[model samples]
Target: MLVDADDCEIVGEANGSAEMERLLIESAPEVVLCDTSPADALRVIEALSGEGAALVLLGEDHSEYQLMADAVLPGWAYLRKEADRIEILGAIRAAGAGLIAVDRSFSLLPGSAFPLADAEILPPDETLTAREREVLQQMTHGLPNKQIAARLNISQHTVKFHVASILAKLGASSRTEAVTSGARRGLVSL
Candidate 1:
Protein backbone atom coordinates (compact mmCIF):
# COMPACT_ATOMS: atom_id res chain seq x y z
CA MET A 1 0.00 0.00 0.00
CA LEU A 2 3.06 2.22 0.07
CA VAL A 3 2.98 4.13 -3.21
CA ASP A 4 4.74 6.80 -1.16
CA ALA A 5 5.52 7.28 2.51
CA ASP A 6 3.69 10.56 2.68
CA ASP A 7 0.19 9.31 1.82
CA CYS A 8 -1.38 6.88 4.26
CA GLU A 9 -3.31 4.69 1.86
CA ILE A 10 -3.42 4.30 -1.89
CA VAL A 11 -7.16 3.44 -1.48
CA GLY A 12 -8.24 3.21 -5.14
CA GLU A 13 -7.47 4.39 -8.64
CA ALA A 14 -9.82 4.93 -11.57
CA ASN A 15 -9.21 5.44 -15.28
CA GLY A 16 -12.56 7.12 -15.88
CA SER A 17 -15.76 8.22 -14.23
CA ALA A 18 -17.55 4.88 -14.63
CA GLU A 19 -14.77 2.96 -12.92
CA MET A 20 -14.43 5.74 -10.35
CA GLU A 21 -18.12 5.46 -9.62
CA ARG A 22 -17.74 1.74 -8.95
CA LEU A 23 -14.72 2.19 -6.69
CA LEU A 24 -16.43 4.95 -4.78
CA ILE A 25 -19.48 2.82 -4.26
CA GLU A 26 -17.50 -0.13 -2.96
CA SER A 27 -14.66 1.45 -1.00
CA ALA A 28 -16.33 4.74 -0.07
CA PRO A 29 -12.99 6.51 0.14
CA GLU A 30 -12.63 9.63 2.24
CA VAL A 31 -11.45 11.50 -0.83
CA VAL A 32 -11.24 10.94 -4.59
CA LEU A 33 -8.30 12.01 -6.73
CA CYS A 34 -9.00 12.61 -10.37
CA ASP A 35 -6.92 13.94 -13.25
CA THR A 36 -9.31 14.37 -16.11
CA SER A 37 -9.92 16.68 -19.02
CA PRO A 38 -11.58 19.91 -17.93
CA ALA A 39 -14.95 19.29 -19.60
CA ASP A 40 -15.20 15.70 -18.40
CA ALA A 41 -14.01 16.54 -14.88
CA LEU A 42 -16.96 18.84 -14.22
CA ARG A 43 -19.46 16.18 -15.27
CA VAL A 44 -17.72 13.54 -13.16
CA ILE A 45 -17.69 15.73 -10.07
CA GLU A 46 -21.32 16.66 -10.56
CA ALA A 47 -22.31 13.01 -10.87
CA LEU A 48 -20.25 11.91 -7.88
CA SER A 49 -21.23 14.68 -5.46
CA GLY A 50 -23.65 12.83 -3.18
CA GLU A 51 -21.11 10.30 -1.89
CA GLY A 52 -19.59 12.75 0.65
CA ALA A 53 -15.99 12.20 -0.51
CA ALA A 54 -14.00 15.36 -1.03
CA LEU A 55 -12.78 15.72 -4.63
CA VAL A 56 -9.16 16.57 -5.39
CA LEU A 57 -8.53 17.53 -9.02
CA LEU A 58 -4.95 17.26 -10.29
CA GLY A 59 -3.68 18.79 -13.52
CA GLU A 60 -1.43 21.50 -14.89
CA ASP A 61 -2.25 25.13 -15.74
CA HIS A 62 -5.80 26.22 -16.64
CA SER A 63 -6.49 28.63 -13.81
CA GLU A 64 -9.90 29.47 -15.24
CA TYR A 65 -10.69 25.80 -15.62
CA GLN A 66 -9.79 25.21 -11.98
CA LEU A 67 -12.06 28.06 -10.97
CA MET A 68 -14.94 26.50 -12.86
CA ALA A 69 -14.38 23.07 -11.32
CA ASP A 70 -13.79 24.44 -7.83
CA ALA A 71 -17.09 26.32 -7.97
CA VAL A 72 -18.94 23.02 -8.42
CA LEU A 73 -18.05 22.04 -4.84
CA PRO A 74 -16.27 24.46 -2.57
CA GLY A 75 -15.05 21.52 -0.48
CA TRP A 76 -12.96 20.29 -3.44
CA ALA A 77 -9.28 21.05 -3.85
CA TYR A 78 -7.54 21.92 -7.11
CA LEU A 79 -3.79 21.41 -7.16
CA ARG A 80 -1.21 21.76 -9.90
CA LYS A 81 1.44 19.13 -10.68
CA GLU A 82 4.22 21.64 -9.97
CA ALA A 83 3.00 22.19 -6.40
CA ASP A 84 5.49 21.06 -3.74
CA ARG A 85 4.88 18.03 -1.53
CA ILE A 86 4.00 20.20 1.47
CA GLU A 87 1.41 22.09 -0.59
CA ILE A 88 0.02 18.88 -2.03
CA LEU A 89 -0.14 17.26 1.40
CA GLY A 90 -1.73 20.39 2.83
CA ALA A 91 -4.39 20.35 0.11
CA ILE A 92 -5.12 16.69 0.79
CA ARG A 93 -5.49 17.34 4.51
CA ALA A 94 -7.68 20.38 3.88
CA ALA A 95 -9.90 18.41 1.52
CA GLY A 96 -10.14 15.59 4.07
CA ALA A 97 -11.20 18.18 6.65
CA GLY A 98 -13.96 19.38 4.27
CA LEU A 99 -12.42 22.71 3.34
CA ILE A 100 -11.77 24.31 -0.02
CA ALA A 101 -8.15 24.45 -1.18
CA VAL A 102 -7.95 26.18 -4.53
CA ASP A 103 -4.53 26.57 -6.12
CA ARG A 104 -2.82 29.96 -5.75
CA SER A 105 -2.95 30.42 -9.54
CA PHE A 106 -6.69 30.99 -9.31
CA SER A 107 -6.06 34.16 -7.32
CA LEU A 108 -4.40 35.75 -10.38
CA LEU A 109 -7.67 35.38 -12.28
CA PRO A 110 -9.66 37.21 -9.61
CA GLY A 111 -12.06 38.80 -12.07
CA SER A 112 -12.63 35.60 -14.03
CA ALA A 113 -16.12 34.21 -13.75
CA PHE A 114 -16.55 30.89 -12.01
CA PRO A 115 -18.30 29.46 -15.04
CA LEU A 116 -19.73 26.33 -13.39
CA ALA A 117 -20.76 27.98 -10.12
CA ASP A 118 -24.31 28.60 -11.16
CA ALA A 119 -24.25 26.12 -14.06
CA GLU A 120 -25.46 23.09 -12.11
CA ILE A 121 -29.21 22.88 -12.82
CA LEU A 122 -30.43 19.89 -10.90
CA PRO A 123 -32.76 20.21 -7.95
CA PRO A 124 -31.29 19.40 -4.55
CA ASP A 125 -33.52 16.39 -4.01
CA GLU A 126 -33.07 14.73 -7.39
CA THR A 127 -29.87 12.82 -6.84
CA LEU A 128 -30.12 9.02 -6.95
CA THR A 129 -28.05 6.24 -5.40
CA ALA A 130 -25.55 4.33 -7.55
CA ARG A 131 -27.81 1.27 -7.69
CA GLU A 132 -30.92 3.24 -8.57
CA ARG A 133 -28.92 4.94 -11.28
CA GLU A 134 -27.85 1.59 -12.69
CA VAL A 135 -31.47 0.45 -12.90
CA LEU A 136 -32.52 3.65 -14.55
CA GLN A 137 -29.69 3.22 -17.04
CA GLN A 138 -30.88 -0.27 -17.86
CA MET A 139 -34.41 0.98 -18.17
CA THR A 140 -33.15 3.44 -20.77
CA HIS A 141 -32.30 0.49 -22.99
CA GLY A 142 -35.87 -0.87 -22.59
CA LEU A 143 -34.47 -3.87 -20.78
CA PRO A 144 -36.67 -6.08 -18.63
CA ASN A 145 -35.83 -6.89 -15.01
CA LYS A 146 -34.73 -10.40 -15.95
CA GLN A 147 -32.42 -9.08 -18.60
CA ILE A 148 -31.07 -6.41 -16.28
CA ALA A 149 -30.44 -8.97 -13.55
CA ALA A 150 -28.54 -11.14 -16.02
CA ARG A 151 -26.53 -8.21 -17.25
CA LEU A 152 -25.67 -6.92 -13.77
CA ASN A 153 -25.11 -10.43 -12.33
CA ILE A 154 -27.59 -9.73 -9.58
CA SER A 155 -30.56 -11.82 -8.63
CA GLN A 156 -33.94 -10.99 -10.11
CA HIS A 157 -35.16 -9.97 -6.66
CA THR A 158 -32.21 -7.65 -6.35
CA VAL A 159 -33.04 -6.23 -9.77
CA LYS A 160 -36.60 -5.73 -8.64
CA PHE A 161 -35.30 -4.01 -5.53
CA HIS A 162 -33.17 -1.74 -7.68
CA VAL A 163 -36.12 -1.02 -9.99
CA ALA A 164 -38.31 -0.11 -7.05
CA SER A 165 -35.57 2.11 -5.65
CA ILE A 166 -35.13 3.74 -9.05
CA LEU A 167 -38.85 4.40 -9.34
CA ALA A 168 -38.96 5.98 -5.91
CA LYS A 169 -35.74 7.93 -6.39
CA LEU A 170 -36.83 9.17 -9.81
CA GLY A 171 -40.44 9.75 -8.69
CA ALA A 172 -41.76 7.50 -11.42
CA SER A 173 -44.60 5.01 -11.22
CA SER A 174 -43.36 2.45 -13.76
CA ARG A 175 -40.28 1.33 -15.67
CA THR A 176 -41.32 3.39 -18.69
CA GLU A 177 -42.01 6.31 -16.43
CA ALA A 178 -38.64 5.89 -14.77
CA VAL A 179 -36.88 5.81 -18.13
CA THR A 180 -38.65 8.95 -19.31
CA SER A 181 -37.98 10.72 -16.04
CA GLY A 182 -34.34 9.69 -16.08
CA ALA A 183 -33.88 10.96 -19.63
CA ARG A 184 -35.55 14.25 -18.86
CA ARG A 185 -33.41 14.71 -15.74
CA GLY A 186 -30.18 14.03 -17.73
CA LEU A 187 -29.61 10.83 -15.75
CA VAL A 188 -30.02 8.65 -18.80
CA SER A 189 -30.65 8.86 -22.55
CA LEU A 190 -32.36 6.77 -25.22
Candidate 2:
Protein backbone atom coordinates (compact mmCIF):
# COMPACT_ATOMS: atom_id res chain seq x y z
CA MET A 1 0.00 0.00 0.00
CA LEU A 2 2.84 2.39 0.83
CA VAL A 3 4.44 1.66 -2.51
CA ASP A 4 1.32 2.94 -4.22
CA ALA A 5 1.03 6.03 -2.06
CA ASP A 6 1.87 9.24 -3.84
CA ASP A 7 3.68 10.62 -0.80
CA CYS A 8 5.92 7.61 -0.20
CA GLU A 9 8.79 6.06 -2.15
CA ILE A 10 9.48 2.34 -1.97
CA VAL A 11 13.09 1.70 -1.09
CA GLY A 12 13.47 -1.95 -0.21
CA GLU A 13 11.55 -4.76 1.43
CA ALA A 14 12.88 -7.44 3.76
CA ASN A 15 11.88 -11.08 4.29
CA GLY A 16 14.06 -11.75 7.31
CA SER A 17 16.12 -10.08 10.00
CA ALA A 18 19.36 -10.20 7.99
CA GLU A 19 17.68 -8.79 4.91
CA MET A 20 15.88 -6.18 6.98
CA GLU A 21 19.15 -5.07 8.51
CA ARG A 22 20.73 -4.86 5.09
CA LEU A 23 17.83 -2.86 3.66
CA LEU A 24 17.86 -0.50 6.61
CA ILE A 25 21.58 0.12 6.30
CA GLU A 26 21.44 0.45 2.54
CA SER A 27 18.22 2.34 1.93
CA ALA A 28 17.91 4.31 5.17
CA PRO A 29 14.41 5.39 4.22
CA GLU A 30 12.56 8.16 6.03
CA VAL A 31 9.97 5.76 7.38
CA VAL A 32 9.81 2.02 8.08
CA LEU A 33 6.60 0.02 7.75
CA CYS A 34 6.46 -3.15 9.83
CA ASP A 35 3.57 -5.64 9.63
CA THR A 36 5.41 -8.76 10.70
CA SER A 37 5.83 -10.46 14.06
CA PRO A 38 6.15 -8.40 17.21
CA ALA A 39 9.73 -9.51 17.70
CA ASP A 40 10.74 -8.39 14.23
CA ALA A 41 8.90 -5.14 14.66
CA LEU A 42 10.73 -4.50 17.92
CA ARG A 43 13.98 -5.23 16.14
CA VAL A 44 13.10 -2.80 13.40
CA ILE A 45 12.32 -0.12 15.97
CA GLU A 46 15.65 -0.74 17.64
CA ALA A 47 17.53 -0.66 14.34
CA LEU A 48 15.91 2.60 13.34
CA SER A 49 16.54 4.22 16.72
CA GLY A 50 18.74 7.37 16.47
CA GLU A 51 18.87 6.78 12.66
CA GLY A 52 15.94 9.16 11.93
CA ALA A 53 13.77 6.42 10.35
CA ALA A 54 10.28 6.66 11.79
CA LEU A 55 8.47 3.41 12.59
CA VAL A 56 4.88 2.54 11.65
CA LEU A 57 4.11 -0.68 13.52
CA LEU A 58 1.04 -2.68 12.47
CA GLY A 59 -0.16 -5.04 15.15
CA GLU A 60 -2.16 -7.99 13.86
CA ASP A 61 -2.11 -11.07 16.10
CA HIS A 62 0.22 -9.86 18.79
CA SER A 63 0.08 -8.17 22.17
CA GLU A 64 -0.53 -4.69 20.80
CA TYR A 65 -0.57 -2.92 24.15
CA GLN A 66 2.86 -4.23 25.02
CA LEU A 67 4.20 -3.28 21.62
CA MET A 68 2.70 0.16 21.85
CA ALA A 69 4.22 0.71 25.26
CA ASP A 70 7.60 -0.37 23.97
CA ALA A 71 7.27 2.17 21.16
CA VAL A 72 8.22 4.88 23.63
CA LEU A 73 10.11 7.42 21.62
CA PRO A 74 8.77 10.11 19.35
CA GLY A 75 8.27 9.35 15.64
CA TRP A 76 6.65 6.00 16.47
CA ALA A 77 3.19 4.83 15.47
CA TYR A 78 1.15 1.87 16.69
CA LEU A 79 -1.78 1.00 14.48
CA ARG A 80 -3.95 -2.09 14.33
CA LYS A 81 -3.86 -4.19 11.17
CA GLU A 82 -7.55 -3.34 10.75
CA ALA A 83 -6.65 0.32 10.20
CA ASP A 84 -7.90 1.56 6.85
CA ARG A 85 -5.48 2.64 4.14
CA ILE A 86 -6.00 6.31 4.89
CA GLU A 87 -5.41 5.78 8.60
CA ILE A 88 -2.27 3.75 7.96
CA LEU A 89 -0.83 6.28 5.57
CA GLY A 90 -1.68 9.18 7.85
CA ALA A 91 0.06 7.49 10.75
CA ILE A 92 3.15 6.84 8.66
CA ARG A 93 3.23 10.43 7.49
CA ALA A 94 2.78 11.73 11.00
CA ALA A 95 5.52 9.49 12.36
CA GLY A 96 7.82 10.44 9.54
CA ALA A 97 7.28 14.05 10.51
CA GLY A 98 8.35 13.26 14.09
CA LEU A 99 4.95 12.87 15.71
CA ILE A 100 3.62 10.07 17.86
CA ALA A 101 0.44 8.55 16.43
CA VAL A 102 -1.90 6.16 18.17
CA ASP A 103 -4.49 4.22 16.20
CA ARG A 104 -8.15 5.18 16.40
CA SER A 105 -8.95 1.54 17.14
CA PHE A 106 -8.82 2.75 20.72
CA SER A 107 -9.81 6.32 21.51
CA LEU A 108 -7.18 7.48 24.01
CA LEU A 109 -8.48 10.93 24.62
CA PRO A 110 -8.89 12.23 28.18
CA GLY A 111 -12.57 11.30 28.56
CA SER A 112 -13.23 9.19 25.49
CA ALA A 113 -15.46 6.15 25.60
CA PHE A 114 -12.57 3.77 25.12
CA PRO A 115 -12.82 1.13 27.79
CA LEU A 116 -10.17 0.19 30.26
CA ALA A 117 -9.16 -3.09 28.73
CA ASP A 118 -9.09 -6.46 30.50
CA ALA A 119 -5.34 -5.94 30.81
CA GLU A 120 -3.27 -2.80 31.31
CA ILE A 121 -1.81 -0.78 28.45
CA LEU A 122 1.51 -1.13 30.31
CA PRO A 123 1.89 -3.16 33.43
CA PRO A 124 4.82 -3.14 35.85
CA ASP A 125 7.38 -1.22 33.83
CA GLU A 126 5.38 2.01 33.83
CA THR A 127 4.11 1.53 37.33
CA LEU A 128 3.82 4.75 39.38
CA THR A 129 4.67 5.02 43.05
CA ALA A 130 1.77 5.14 45.54
CA ARG A 131 2.01 8.91 45.97
CA GLU A 132 2.55 9.46 42.30
CA ARG A 133 -0.57 7.45 41.57
CA GLU A 134 -2.49 9.67 43.95
CA VAL A 135 -1.28 12.77 42.16
CA LEU A 136 -2.19 11.19 38.84
CA GLN A 137 -5.71 10.45 40.06
CA GLN A 138 -6.04 14.08 41.09
CA MET A 139 -4.80 15.03 37.66
CA THR A 140 -7.50 12.87 36.13
CA HIS A 141 -10.04 15.12 37.82
CA GLY A 142 -8.25 18.10 36.31
CA LEU A 143 -6.97 19.27 39.63
CA PRO A 144 -4.23 21.85 39.75
CA ASN A 145 -1.26 21.48 42.05
CA LYS A 146 -2.73 23.63 44.78
CA GLN A 147 -6.01 21.73 44.72
CA ILE A 148 -4.28 18.39 44.61
CA ALA A 149 -2.10 19.34 47.57
CA ALA A 150 -5.12 20.44 49.52
CA ARG A 151 -7.04 17.30 48.68
CA LEU A 152 -4.17 14.97 49.37
CA ASN A 153 -3.18 16.85 52.55
CA ILE A 154 0.32 17.46 51.20
CA SER A 155 2.37 20.55 50.45
CA GLN A 156 2.14 22.04 46.97
CA HIS A 157 5.84 21.36 46.57
CA THR A 158 5.27 17.71 47.33
CA VAL A 159 2.37 17.65 44.87
CA LYS A 160 4.63 19.06 42.18
CA PHE A 161 7.23 16.40 42.88
CA HIS A 162 4.64 13.64 42.62
CA VAL A 163 3.25 15.11 39.41
CA ALA A 164 6.68 15.07 37.85
CA SER A 165 7.20 11.50 38.96
CA ILE A 166 3.84 10.47 37.48
CA LEU A 167 4.65 12.07 34.13
CA ALA A 168 8.06 10.36 34.04
CA LYS A 169 6.68 6.96 34.94
CA LEU A 170 3.87 7.20 32.36
CA GLY A 171 6.16 8.67 29.67
CA ALA A 172 3.84 11.63 29.38
CA SER A 173 4.91 15.21 28.94
CA SER A 174 1.76 16.76 30.36
CA ARG A 175 -0.84 16.08 32.98
CA THR A 176 -3.57 15.32 30.46
CA GLU A 177 -1.40 12.80 28.64
CA ALA A 178 -0.57 11.15 31.94
CA VAL A 179 -4.27 10.93 32.78
CA THR A 180 -5.13 9.42 29.43
CA SER A 181 -2.30 6.89 29.65
CA GLY A 182 -3.25 6.10 33.22
CA ALA A 183 -6.86 5.52 32.22
CA ARG A 184 -5.76 3.15 29.47
CA ARG A 185 -3.66 1.23 31.97
CA GLY A 186 -6.59 0.97 34.41
CA LEU A 187 -4.66 3.18 36.77
CA VAL A 188 -7.14 6.09 36.68
CA SER A 189 -10.65 6.91 35.47
CA LEU A 190 -12.08 10.02 33.94
Cα deviation at 90, candidate 1, in Å, is: 1.3
User: Candidate 2's residue-wise lDDT over 1-190, tens digit each?
Assistant: 7668988888998886668779988997888877767667667666766776788877754344344445444577777877888988999889889886766544443333233344544556766777887788889889899999999999999999888888887788988988988877756656
Give the residue spans of candidate 1 off by over 4 A: 5-7, 60-74, 113-190
User: Candidate 1: lDDT of 25?
Assistant: 83
State the lDDT at 16 in candidate 2: 63
Q: Candidate 1: minimum summed lDDT over ten consecutive residues — where? A: 110-119
Local distance difference test scores for all models:
0.68, 0.73
